[model samples]
Target: MEIETTGIPGCYVLQARLLRDRRGSFIKTFHTPRFEELGLRTDWREEYFSASAKGVVRGMHFQLPPVDHAKMVFCLTGEVLDVVVDLRRGSPAFGTALGFTLSAENGRGLYLPTGCAHGFVSKAEDSGMYYKVTSVHAPEQDAGIAWDSIAFDWPVSDPELSDRDRRHPRFADFETPFVFDAAKAAQ
Candidate 1:
């Protein structure tokens, strides 16, 4: 895997090595050593995926600290404009965002350290997004900032959002508790 910085201090955009043949292709999605060498959190406890139709918007979500997580996500099928907002209280990139296009064709992915909110918009029908997270899911700990409040430029105006997601507080109204500790997050 090759790593690229996401401008946000600890966030990385990973490009998986794809091997192609006459019949098909194969790619190594994860390798413990490489992630360790890069100082990313590797203690993943759960994995999940979300499938959305075109124009559907899925997130801007994160869990509260003590239950907060770092995530590595990639597009398993179709495509998405993956978006993340820095919410680390003392982060240099706080309140900012970055967007990357993840698709089955390019085999690209994203790694977000704890404190950023993550979400995506589907660019194709039946888009599937897969994730490997450092923390287990907790319903009570789940939270998000309003998707429409962030500065990132989403492609669609009429994004399909769930009522809960639609009701999330605006970015300006959020009071983040996550702190930006390089050493702590590297674990």
Candidate 2:
């Protein structure tokens, strides 16, 4: 796998090696040694998969400090326009947003460190997104910036969103609890 950095500190785009043949294709999403070598988190505490129809938007989500986590996500079935926003105060990329097209066809995934918010817009029917996170879900700590508050240009203007997502605070109005650490930024 090859890991490329994103605009956000500690965020990465993981390009997994895909081996294809007449039978099918194989993708290795995680390899401990390689991750350890790159200082990426390998201790995943939870895994999840979400299936969404086209025009669905889910995102700008993150957990507050004390329960925040690092996440690795990939598209398993269809395609999505994945976006991440830096929420760590004092970081060079704070408040900046980055977009990546993740799909089964491209074998690309994203690695977002604790102080980032994540979200996506489904680009095809039955899009499946898989995630590995370093912490268990903490509902009380679950928080997010409003989907329409960031700098991303989502494809659909009236995309469907969950009530919880729709009620999130706007980015500019929310006070971030995360503080950027230069040491962790190297990871």
Best by lDDT: 2
Q: Pick the candidate with the highest TM-score.
A: 2
Tens digits of lDDT, candidate 2, 1-187: 9999777889999999988899988899999999999999999999999999999999989988798999999999999999999999999999999989999899999999998999999999989999999999999999999988998878889999999999999999999999999799733
Candidate 1 Cα misplacement greater than 4 A, ranges: 185-187
- RMSD in order of candidates: 1.1, 0.9
- Kindly report which residue pairs in candidate 1 clash with one another: none
- Candidate lDDT values, in order: 0.90, 0.93
- Output the worst ten-in-a-row residue range by lDDT, candidate 2: 178-187
lDDT of 2 at 109: 99
- How much lDDT does candidate 2 score? 0.93
Model 2 CA deviation exceeding 4 Å by range: none
